[model samples]
Target: MSWEEMLTTVQESLITYWDGLVGSLPKLGAALFLIFLTWGAVTLARAFIRKLGSKTRMRKNLTDVLSMLAGTGLWLMGTLIALAIVFPSITPGKALTTLGLGSVAIGFAFKDTFENFLAGILILLREPFAIGDHVECDDIEGQIEEITIRDTHVRQTDGQLVVVPNHLLFQNPVTVRTNRDLRRTTIICGVAYGENVDDARSVIEAAVREVDSVRNDVKDVQVFAQEFAASSINFEVTWWTGSQPLDIRTSRDQVVAAVKRALDDAGIEIPFPYRTLTFNEPIPVREQGAQDEAA
Candidate 1:
């Protein structure tokens, strides 16, 4: 109960704690060394996975996922081993139980993140699209720059980078524009109603096929009489071309120009909108110069 008795007890307790700490130094050192080795092993595992993935027909994103999982497994095992070495009382069972509970808590906290991750995994597995492929999903049209575990980086045609959650792409309808080497493009070219339908069709088809970008050889150019407009008869000119935005645009420009030139040479008029406005009252109109002079 006295101060001296309390002081002696505290000193003895400190001495025992110091001795225990000194005795456990070797264990701590061993655990640190094991952790260092584990880091090296994880690095090697990732390098090996990447090499194998490249050699095989696996997707790059799937390769990334596999490497990540391998690293995670290695780190988990190493951590358990290190903890057991540092503290002899701790067992693998206890460590795994604690990890499971922590993981549950983390999963609850990051529900959306896990959803995207799972969606990304499915996307990588399904191989619906690939990096550098042009895709459109829910108004986001772009080339797939990268596919990560939680988000996909889309570089839009306008050069804007959009980070979209993988879940949205997985859940929504995605249009892969570059799914094949060739894409079908249709343009309705209208000629004057007085023009010969058969002659106009032949002219348009020949012109479209002549275009540099049009893949008319692989797929025949089709010029069908789609409908009769108020001013002209519309022909739906369809053909195959390169499967890229720029390629499509270039083909369209060339096709339009070639068709116009051919139609002009063939004496076929590409009619403009013919509007006849009916009014209850007629108003006098004057030329611009006359109106200005009158004003």
Candidate 2:
């Protein structure tokens, strides 16, 4: 086609498209307004959810999830309404069908993300552990700082923060250290074989009871001669103390010191490892004077 003819056709097409856009301006405006309206509605709904969550005894993580879900639903509804207003041909059912078909691909692409999300939801619902609770899972031993949709934040003993995937926590065995008010701790104390077992056991039990943190009212202290070691007799000392890690450490330290002092004062020996040498054959020796004379 000639250049002028091509130019004329392009001009006509632009004018037609422009006229169509102008004719649909009202619907476009409505769609934009609906989006804003949806935002406001979702904001109000989230606020209401937060208030409701506060009134109940639900966990903060669960409350956050509920509010997020409500917002998501409201936004989704608004998006469908806007789409329908703009196109006048789209329906919610059709939109859902399209999403269903696309979701397969999306799920495959983000498999781990979806797994963590689901695991987080289950964890929140089951209440296995909560924020500020001390837990040990796999190699992570720390207090739970926060629980989110993708990961859990743990503050380790040394103040290092660890981000753990929710799925790993759900699948693995988690030890909730602070689940109760008291936890049992054991210390192995060894005395010289010559010391009286009964005497040593009494001394250890008494020393453990003297510790401030040890629970004496419960009468949970136990000291038994567990086994004979290479150099000493071992006493398995067990007691009940506070459940926190710091509490356990402090109680153990106090018990060890108290036991050592008590044993020393009573003249009961806490022996060190001893070794004796044996000669398979006799060795010949010459006096220094005799060797000098021979030389």
Candidate 3:
């Protein structure tokens, strides 16, 4: 209970604190070093995969997928190594068990995204349609611009790019318009009831032939008397053109314009709808009565 006793107690406490700090220095340094190495390795792995992706012969979507998958795998491996080095007691088996148990919860939370991811993989592997192919899925129609693990990129005919989930692509019917080398178009024209059907057919066929953008791969340039329409005789002009959907649209416009000019030159009157209105008589307005005003 004196000054010397107090001094002795303070010395003992300082010695214990210093020993504890010295003992913990190695563990702290090891953890820090492992974390730094893991970060550097992950960065390097992504850079390498990005370079590889650029050189790949795969489609743009597939290339992106490969790069992402490779980068993720390398980062995961680096994380596992770093964790094991820093905390040796945490075994890989325990980590796997924990992740497996947690996956069930995560699966439900990300069900839609996971389905989209799986669907994207199927689309890429099956090669249903490649980039630049025009596809109609559900009510959306556009050209395939890019594919991803979760979504598909499309450039619409109107020059807009849309991002659609892959699940939607798989769940709905996809119509690819430009798969074949040629595309056929049907253009119907109506002429007066008494016009020469054979002569009109010949004129229409010649008009179709004059279109330079039209393809010759069609079975035949047929002008059929399809129907006796309400006002005139319907002549069907069917032809083919090997062009992209946008180009097909332009080509169709050209063909239609040419056919219209030819029909005008041939004196074929394309009549409009007719309606007749009949009136019995006009109703006369009655003058107001003075007696009614009084009431």
Candidate 4:
């Protein structure tokens, strides 16, 4: 091409591009202003939802999920409006269609996260185990410390904090130890075979009733003959006490101590293991004086 012709083409192109850019500046500025307004709106919407949640006595975690959802919906609407303004060719409908495909991809990528989120919402609504309720799921034993959208914080009996995914608790069997005011606990107490069965039962029942935490008023102490061991006869002593793990431990300790004392006073023997050894052939034994001389 000729140099003059190339220069003339470049000038026309620059002028056309400059005019287009100048024309787009207003739309860009308006879109930016709209985005700022959207941010303010989102903040206000979340605050309003939280306040309403508080008034309605909703749980903290549930309120958090609701506020997050409200904010997300508002932000999406604002973003769609801004996109429409910035690029008039892309309508909200087209934007939503594109987002739908993108959302499917996102859901697949974060499958577990979404599953846990839904499980958390259901758990909060159902109110199965509240905070401070001691529960055992699978092998985990703990108190419900906190519940979030993704996981639940469990304070174990040993004072360890475990963050467990909500799906596991929702899917697995959960034993709520503190579901009721009192729980029944049993222990195997044994006495010598020579001891009278009726006397031992009476002694164990009396000892369990004497425990400070035992609920003797609500339920009578129970003592049943369980089995005969190598050295002693076992009695299953049962009583009701507080439902917490600590409460159970404390009551068990008190009951054990009280039973031991009662058994000692009644001259009842709590026998230990006994072993008998038999030799098929005789062996020669050295005298103690001969062994000492060799040492």
- State the C-alpha lDDT per candidate: 0.92, 0.93, 0.81, 0.91
Clashing pairs in 2: none
Rank order (by lDDT, best first): 2, 1, 4, 3
Q: What is the overall TM-score of model 1 with all chains considered together?
A: 0.81
Per-residue lDDT of 161-193 in model 3, one digit per residue for the tens?
Answer: 899999999988899887876788888898887
- lDDT (Cα, 0-100) at 179 in candidate 3: 84
Query: TM-scores of all models?
Result: 0.81, 0.81, 0.67, 0.77
Model 1: per-residue lDDT, tens digit, 145-190?
A: 9998899999998999999999999999999999999998889889
* Weakest 10 consecutive residues of candidate 4 by summed lDDT: 61-70
Local accuracy of candidate 2 as per-residue lDDT tens digits, 110-169: 999999999998998889999989999999999999999899999999999999999999
Q: What is the C-alpha RMSD of each candidate to the true structure, in Å?
A: 5.5, 3.9, 8.6, 5.2
**Residue 154 CA displacement from its true place in model 3, Å:** 3.4
Q: Per-residue alpha-carbon lDDT of model 4 for 204-245, expressed as tens digits?
A: 888888889999999888899999888889999899999988
Error of 4 at 292 (Å): 23
The backbone clash count of each candidate, in order, is 0, 0, 0, 0
The residue ranges of model 2 lying beyond 4 angstroms of the native Cα positions read 1-37, 85-88, 276-295
